[model samples]
Structure formats: structure tokens, C-alpha cells
Target chain A: MKVGILGAGQLGRMLAIAGYPLEMSFSFYDTSGSPSVGFGDILVDKGGSGAKLEEFLNKVDVVTYEFEHLPLELTQKIEKLKPLYPSSKSIEVCQNRAKEKALFTELGIPTAEYRVATSAEELAEAAAELGCPVVAKSVTEGYDGKGQAVLRDVADAEQAWSSINHDAVIVESFINFSRELSIIAARSTTGEVAFYPLAENNHHDGILRYSIAPAPKVSTELQQQAESHIKALINDLDHVGILTLELFETPEGLIANEMAPRVHNSGHWSIEGAASSQFENHLRAIAGLPLGNTAANKPTCMINIIAEKGDKEAILKLPYAHLHLYGKEERTGRKLGHVTVQADSYEELVWRVKNVATFLPGSPEFISSIS
Target chain B: MKVGILGAGQLGRMLAIAGYPLEMSFSFYDTSGSPSVGFGDILVDKGGSGAKLEEFLNKVDVVTYEFEHLPLELTQKIEKLKPLYPSSKSIEVCQNRAKEKALFTELGIPTAEYRVATSAEELAEAAAELGCPVVAKSVTEGYDGKGQAVLRDVADAEQAWSSINHDAVIVESFINFSRELSIIAARSTTGEVAFYPLAENNHHDGILRYSIAPAPKVSTELQQQAESHIKALINDLDHVGILTLELFETPEGLIANEMAPRVHNSGHWSIEGAASSQFENHLRAIAGLPLGNTAANKPTCMINIIAEKGDKEAILKLPYAHLHLYGKEERTGRKLGHVTVQADSYEELVWRVKNVATFLPGSPEFISSIS
Candidate 1:
């Protein structure tokens, strides 16, 4: 089977890897050439959207994107020739905060108290209602904690409002959640849901620092709540492909934070640890095939080796961590690479993740390896 | 860094997995798509031999190959573009029986007593040099124990010689060896040598069935012999990339059976069991990067999942055997996948490999309980 991917990136590279067992042929198209699409047949063209798209569609059996920001009009145009999963309409909702939150509410899912802030005055009013220590985010084009701000008091509201150059923003109460968890579920075109283990994620300066599979400390009730919301959303959207729903484990209950409409970086460890990788599962879903097993052989912890002004060799010394380095030439606060470590015990995983970075120049090793 | 591969097959796919670190990019170009090139970026065209090769010349920084049959013309054409590791000269030797044996003799590598036979008269003369029960093989294109026949007596010799359709055949004395073993070693683009642990292999009907890493019967004497021959070969050919030498262990000594000039299937267990996989090491050699550690984490036994006459689900029942299914859609004597199981003890490793076959059906389980 021939499968075509738009935006040839690491995600597409992994999808091709997953397709290896099924003998699925993959070809990729990207504008500037994705750094991570080092594997498979790739074609890079700098033409504008919809240019030569008909020709591209003719060569492939199916079309999918590695990213949500793919030109919807171009994809819609190609839809005439081949199938594009997660429909262009779905990307519209997931790309904007207002649409995503509204859809969540309509689907009867739990979320934080949020209000639309089209102006600075509305932002202040929403902040007053949501309380101090609130989060104000741009309605669109925000990721990796970018285009978001924290309003500690009334003082930061105006600054936060203007800081977002976009037309609209969202203001919500900063829930004092115990921890953060994420669910990565794949919904096939046929409405099949294959959920990987709930992942516990830790962040450093708004960057995903670590993720542990079979998220430790998650209650069965909380897991059920998350799964239910994911299923409802999949059914509501008639979605196809993987959905990464970030959630907050609050004292009140679980609350939705944000959702990525495609493969999430938080679930990268599944490549070696899981029975079938997220990339493979996503391809299976998009290709309309039965999902493979999502079981893990052992506990796996993935630590993002953020290259923050240092050499990579220091942390790569850890023998157990499966190091993945992105072929990014410059490393200035870049996601240069990640490390996945599978161990018999959680304690060993913690030891490896915490201390491995200490070998690097600037990354201060955690004092006691506590969350 | 950028590295180029002449042929894209499973070996190239495995290398891409290993190239996760070092932030390296490997580009593979096969005449046609190969299953191994499924996960990595593949370049294809009939344009490589002419000025169309100009687009690829400066693009790839270094060059290596996934197999010995890298077209001699393409290898020579790309020589001016960048360094081609192991050199095009080695292929001329490894691709032919007379040249391979002569090269082995030149390097003082212990190989079986053999003579080249291009005709019936020559076959009779070579039989005198290597006594009866000799193996007659076509000088080229013989693989996986195919295109070869056993000569038991004088009557069998005439039938076998004419049957080998190739222009010439090499007659090798069949040694009464107890077992087969293989060694995979790496030589950097500059000729630095590193040897992975020796692997003990078992074949069924002349096809590799299973391989156990850190070969159970390892002794100081055998280790020294294996390492010296590999080092000698590397220095003689000024070889680069990986060299996988297959051998037979007999009462007399270790005898070289055949050599694969790239990553071999017998070393697949290294992906999970060794500190660094053979695939990664191959890319490292081609990229001129520092090689990774190749020490075995634990003993691992791997079983080749062949599509025998019956039973498909039997392999899924084996515990701890990491199953890898090559996505090939075919039946009847096709190699579709493999399973590798790691354990603290050889008894456990052996039990897993032997009993894992039972999980697929048409076989009875013989694996013992932990107790």
C-alpha cells in the first residue's frame, strides 16, 4: 500500500517506521524539508499552497499531515483525489483555543472556568471572575507554552493582553492541580479507539521535561474520567488519527488543558516500550486497519534532553537511556533530542532521568529526584 | 552529519534506528524500494550514473552501503563525491567466490579448503583437493543456502557441477563442525576496529533459525581467534563500516564459512540487547562519528520467524520475546519477522528461543516455569 504524508517531519519518519511491518510504501512532501524526515522517500518543494498538489495526490494512495498547521485549503483540494484524515475541519477546532474549549463543553467534558477575551478589558473582567494567578493565552498558533502568559495579579493583565498579537485570547483560573497527565488515544476512520497508557508529564520552564508511562499515582477513577472524555471527543468530532489530550489532576476533578490533533511528543517512548508504537497505531487508524496491542513490556520513562546552551555528550553517557537527537544544526533553547529509558523499577528510571543531565554543563541535576 | 548508503534493505532500516543519537542523517538509494529503507529517507532514480548524480554529489557528506551487491558502477561513480567506506574494491572481492576466498587467504583469515571449478573436468580436479562430501556453490548470486548442492560421492559430483547454472562454482570441503557462530565487527571510515560479542547461530535446512548472543560456548581461545581474524581482515582490506563473518566451530579450529559485507540478520538481537546496535555502528562508521559502546546488557536469544507450513499465532504466546514482524505480504517459505528474548541466564535464553516457536501454532510448548 502506498501512503503519502504531508509535512515530512519526525512524526512522519516514525509513521514510516511503524509502516515497515505492513510493507506500506510511504512518500513525503514538505515545503522547507523537515529535519527529522531522514527516513523514507521525501520530496521538498517551496511552492505555495495547492501548487502541484493535484500531481502530488496522483502519486499517493492516501494523504495525511505530520502537523496541524498544514494548509487546510491545500489538503481540502487534495481530498478530491485522495483521503486526508482528521479532516481539515478538525484541525480548525484544535488549532484555536476558543473552538477547542467550546467543543469540549458541548461534548460535556470538564474544563477550567474560561471566558473569551477579545479585548484587554474583557480579559481583566474574566481574570477577576477566574481569580488571581490566572493564565491568559492567545486563541491560536500557541504551543510548547509559547503565546501564553501568567497574570499573577491585576498588574500583569494589560501586559498579557497586548503580548498576544492575535485577535483573541482566553483567560482562565490557574487550577492548583496536584499533577499533570495526558491521554494519547487513536480514533480510526471507523470510530475505533485505541488508548495507550495514561502518561504523567513534568515540565521545566514550560517545556516537557519528562513523561512516565502507566502514569504513576493516577487513580483508577481519574483514568476512567480521562478515557471517557477522550472517547466522547472522538465520537463527537468523528475524528481519525491520534489525539493527545492534556489534563490537570485537580482537587475538584480532572480538567482539560489543551489537545494536539496529531501525534504528541509526550508519547515518544512507546517506540521501544509498547507492543505497538503510537506512530504505527496512527498509521493503522488512518489506513483503516485494526489497531495493534498498546501494552508496555516494562515501566518506561522518557526525559527530554533539552539542549539549553551545552554539549550533548554529557547526558548521552547514560547507558540505559535510548537517546534520540534531532538533526537541528543550531541548539539555542532547541529541542535537540530526547532520551527514553525502560527499567524494571521506577526508582531506577528516576535515578537515570534525574542524574543523567547533571553530566551536562548547565542542567542542574534535581536535588533528590522528587516531583 | 550526512551519510549515504548504496543499497537500502533491512540493514539500512536497522541502521536508521541506531542513528537516533549523534543527530546524524543517513540517505539510502536503492535501485528499487527495499523493505529496509522503509524507515529512512530513500533516494531513487536511473539518474545516479550521469550528471543527474550532481544533485547527490555534494548533498551526501559520506558514503557506505547496506549490502555487498552495491552496483560496481555506482560505487565507482560516487567515489569522487565523497569517501566510500570499505571501498568499492572490497565488493569485487566479496561478490565472487574465487575473489572472496583469495582475499581471505591474502588476509590470513582461516577459511575452508576450496578450489574454483568452471567445468566438469575442473570439478573433478577440485574434488581431489577437497575430498568427498564437498559443497558445490555457484560463484555468484548464491544466498541463504540456495544455488548450492552437496556432493556425497563421485556420482553426485557430475550432477551438482552441471546443475550449478552459473559460469563457475567453488567446491569447499564440508567440515564436521559441532555448531555455527558469527562475528560482526566495525571499522571506521579511517579503519578503527570494534567487535560486537560473538553470536552462536543455528540453522534449519541451511537457513538461519536462531542466534544466541555472547555465544554460550565462548572461551578465551575462541575469543582470541575470532578477534584476531576480524582485526586482520579490517587492516588488510582497509575496511570500513561493518563486516559480518559467518563461521563453523569444529574440532580442528574456527573455519570461516562466508562473509556479509554489511549488517547481518544474525546480529539483530543487538538492537535491544547490546548497548549499541550494529545498525547504529554502521552509520557511525560511515558518518565518521565516534562509535557507541557494543557491550551486551544481558544474554539474548533470537528466533527467526519463518512461515512454515502451519500455525501463525504461536509466536505471540512467548513471554519476553520482543517480536518484530517485517511488513511483507507473502506466504510460503517467506521470512516475515523475528522474536528476541533477553534473560539473565543462557538456560532461560535458550528456553525462550526454543519454546517461542510453540506460541505460533503447529508446535508443542516446552518452556519451563520460573520455579
Candidate 2:
């Protein structure tokens, strides 16, 4: 099967890697022009022209995107010519914070209290009404902590709104949480759904630094709760392929932070830690194949290789560390690659992760649920 | 690093898949005009000219081969320009039966009584001397039970010799073996060695049909014995990358059959059953990276998809089964792909393998050391 992928970045490269063994060919449509993935037939549709879209559609049997923040008009147009997994509705909802929060509320999935603000006065009123230290994010086009600001006081709303640089912003009250977690689930064309073990994620500067799989001390009830909530959203959206729901574990309960309608960073550990990786499952789901086993085989920790290249020799020397480097030049805040450390126990996993971090110059201190 | 592979068959395709994650780029030099691997930079050197050879060398940092059956002169030329893993010496010994047997004898490994014959009369004499029921095989370029004939009596030697079609043939007394097994080990440039657990193989019509890993009922003493024999050959050859030794398990002990200097079909189980796959280990060894753990994580069975495609949906429905297709059109007696089934126990593994076999037409009956 020939698959057309939107956004030719590391995720698409990894997806193509996983898809090759299944005898699936890939053609990547990169709007960024400078695609990170070198192999496969790539169409650089920088202008998103109809002719290029037609050519890409003619080359593939189905369409899927690695990045959810795609132009909805382009995705919708592609959907008319070929099958698109997760549909344009997923992109539409995920791109707008208000739409996403409304869907979460309709599905009974808990999220932070917030109000949409079109003016500075409304932003201040929402902040004052909800409490202090609220997060104000653009209603559209925001990710990786971009186009966002933290208002510690209601008096700072004017500055936050102006800096956000959007017509409207969603002001959300900050929820006190113990840790961040993410649940990745896949729904196939035949309506088969499978969920991977929850991953406990650590972030610095709003970028994911570490993700530990089968998050330690997760109760059966909590896992079921997370699964049920995600299942509700998946079925409601009629979503196909991988859907990742990010959560904040609070003393009150689990609160939905955000969700990505694609293969996510937190689920990268599945490449080695689980029986079937998220990349494989996503491809399988999109191709209408049966979902594979999502069970974790061992405790695993994935550390992002950001900005700079690590000592390849030193990292490869660690028997438990699997190094994955994207063929890209180093740039500040850019994700070059990641190393996944697997061990029989969480204790050994933590030790190995720390050892691997030494080779990565600016890596954050290794931490996990157990650690 | 850029690695050049001699053959662009499924093995080379899989090697490329394994190497890509290590941030390695591949340029395949396929002597056959029809290269099966679709991805990567492929150069079809069908005429074997100096210009094409130089072009291939200029594209890669190091050279290796997936298939050993190549023109020794060409390999020797490439070796002078680039570092070739396992070297030409290993290839020279592996290409001929007499040299391979001599290496085994010199290393004090046990083998069946055999004699070389240059004529049909000599072949009959050797069969008579070996007391009939002997197997006659070409002295060079024979694999997968090809270029071989089984003689029930000395009178059948003339037909057998003619059928082999080689200038010289080796006639050996057929030993009564309990099962066929293979040991896969990798040696790095720094002389670090790691061995995967032995895999019990089953063949039909000279083609391998199934391989069960961590062969059931194997004693630690037996495993160590297998390991030590392969280790001796690896060190003796001063070989780097994967070295696979096929053996016949008789009541007396393990008798050496033959050796391949590159990754073998028997080690395909390592892709999922072992902590590190043979393909990954081979690349790591050739790249001068540290060897990974070779321990088996579960009892696994690899069933070869030969000559025909299977019911993919049916096979995929078996949660334990992982399908790998080579993107090749099905033809008679051709290896199309393989399915790997992993289970926590041998009992469950056998059951799942049988279930998987139902989908693959013409697959041999499921058999293993345990079942």
C-alpha cells in the first residue's frame, strides 16, 4: 500500500520506518519545504497548490498526517480524493482550544476551568474570577508553549493578551497537579480500539524532556478511568488512527490538559518497550489492519535529544540504551533524536537513563514516577 | 555513517531498516538488475564495471554484504577501497565446502565423515566407502538444500553427481540427527562478542520453513557448548559482524554442518524474541559500535512466508503474530516474507504458530523442540 503522509519530520520518518516492514510504501507531503526525512518520494507543497495536492493524492491510496497542526482546508481537500485517518474534524477540533475544551466537556472529560477572552478586560475578569496564575493561550495556532503566557496576577492580563498576538485567547486557571501523564489509543477503521500503558511525562520550558512508560504506581482504577475517557472521545469523534490525550493528575481527579490526534512523543517508548510500537499501530489503524498488542514489555525511559548531538560512541556503549538520531543538523530547541532505556525494573531503568543522560550535554536531570 | 551493501534482497532491505535508526544512510550495490529493496540509494551494477564499483565506493563509508554468493574478485576490489566486515577471508572459506570443513576440523569441531569427488566414479566409490545412503553436494555455491542429491545406494551416484552440476562434489555419510539448529553470534571491530540463544530450525525441500528460538529443552551446558564452538570459529576467522553456524544435533553431540559469514535466516527470530535483533547487531558490529544484549525475552517462532502471500488480516488477528512482507510478488519457491510469533511460554507459542500457519498456504506443519 502506498501511504501519503503530511509533514515530513521525525515522526513521519519513524512511521515510514515502521511501515516498511509491513510492505507499505510512503510519499511524504512536506509544506515546510525542508523535510527532515530524506528517503521516499516527497512532494514539497510549500504553497499548498491544488496541482501538487492532486499529484500527491494520485500517488497514494490513503492519507495521514504526523503533525495535527495542519491546514484544515488542505486536509479536507485531501479527504475528498483519498481516505484520511482521524479525519479533518480531528484537525479542526484540535487546532482550536475552545473547540477542544468544549468537546472534552461534552464528553465528561475534566479539564481546567477557563473562559474565552477577546479583550484585555475580559482576560483580566476571567483570571480574577477563576483565581491567580492562569495560563492564557491563543485560541488557535499554539503548541510547544508557543503563543502562550502565564499571568501570575490579573493586572498582567493586558500584557499577556497583547503578547499572545491572536484575535482571541483562552484563559485557563492553573490546576495544581502531582505530575503530567499521557494515554495513547488507536482506533481502527473497523472500530477496534487499543490503548497503550500510560506514560508519565516530564517537561521543561513546555517541551517534553522525559517520558516513562507504564507509569509507576498507577492504580487499576486510574488506568480504567483514563481509558474510558479517551474511548469516549475517540468514539465520539469517529476518529481513526492514534489519539493521544494528555492529562494532569490532580488531588481531585484527572484533568485533560490537551490532546493530539496523531502519534505523540510520549508514546515513542513503545518502539522498544511494547510488543507493537505506536508508529506501527498507527499505520495499522490507518491501513485498516487489526490493532496490535499495546502491552508494555518492560519499564522504559525515553530521553529527548534536543538541540545538540550527543556522544554517539558513549551512548552506544550502554547495552540497555537504544540511540535513535534524526539525520538533522543541531539547532537550539530542535529535537534531533531520542534515546530509549529499557530495564527489567524501574530502579535499573532510572540508573541507565541517568547514565545515558551524561552523554547528552544539556539534558535535564532524569526523573520518573518511581524516581 | 554511509554503509554500502552488496545485495539488495530482503536481508539488505532489513539491514537498511535496522541501520536507519542509528542515523546511518544506505547505498545498495545490487548485482542483480532487479533489486527487491525499493528504498535507499540503489546502484544496479549488473555489468560489474570499474566505473560503477568506484561510484558505489564513493557513496559509502564502509562496505558489507547481505548475500555471500558474489564474485570474489569484485569483493576483493571493494575491500581494497573500503573496510569490509567479516573480510574476504571469511567469504573465501564460506564459499567452498572443503575449506569450511577444514576450518571446522582445524578448530576441533565434530563433523560427519566426508570425501571429495572429482568424477562420478569417485562419487560412487565415496558412497560405497561411506556405506551407502550418503548425501552428495556441490563443493561450492550450494545453499537451501540446492545443488544436492541424496543417494540410497552407490549405484545412484552417477545420477546424483550429474544432478549436482558442479566440477567437484562432497559425499558424506548421512548422520542420524535429532534436530537441526543454528547459533548466531556477532563480533565487533574491538573484538567484543555477543551470542543469541540457539534457534531450532525446520526445513522442507531444502528451504527453511520455521525457526523456534531459545530452543526448548536446551541445557545450559548445551547452550555453552554451541556458543563455544561458534566463538572459536568467529575468533579464528577474526570475523566481524554476524557469523551463523548451522549444526546437526545428534546423540553424540553437536556436529558442525556449515557457516555463513553474514546474518542467516535462522536468526530472524532475534528481530523480536531477543533483546537485540541480529540485523541490528550486524550493523552495530560493522559500524564498530558496542554489541547489544543477545538474551531472548520470550519463546518465539518465525515462520517463513514462501512462494505465496497469506491472509494478512487473518494472520494479523492473532495478536501475538507480527507480519513482515518483502514487497515482492509471489512466485514458486520464492521467499516472500515471514511472520514472527512471540509468546510468554513455549506451549502458547506452539499454539499461536499453528494458528498463524493456517493463514499461510503451503507453510510446513508447525514443529519445535517442545511441541
> How badly does each model clash, as a count of residue pairs?
15, 0
Could you tell me the lDDT of residue B329 within candidate 1? 47
All models, RMSD in angstroms: 4.9, 1.9
Q: What is the lDDT for B320 in model 1?
A: 61
What are the candidates' individual DockQ scores?
0.30, 0.66
The digit string of per-residue lDDT tens for model 1 on B3-74 reads 766666666666665664566676777665343455555667544444435555566778777777666887
User: C-alpha displacement of B304 in model 2, angstroms?
Assistant: 1.1
Model 2 chain A poorest 10 in a row by lDDT? A362-371
TM-score of each: 0.82, 0.96
Q: Write the per-residue lDDT of candidate 2 for residues A47-132, one digit (tens) a residue.
A: 66555777888999999998888778888888888999989999899889999999999999999999999999999999999998
Give the winner by lDDT: 2
- Candidate 1 per-residue C-alpha lDDT over A1-371 given as tens digits, one digit per residue, 9 for 90 to 100: 68888877667766776676555778888776444566566677666545655566777888887788666577677777788887777788888889999988998888888998988888888888888889988988888888898988876778898887668899888788888899989988777788888898888677887788978777788778999999888778778988889999888888898888888888898876776778877887887766666776668877665665244544444557566765554464566566677778777777766666564443345323544
How good is the docking of model 2, as DockQ?
Answer: 0.66
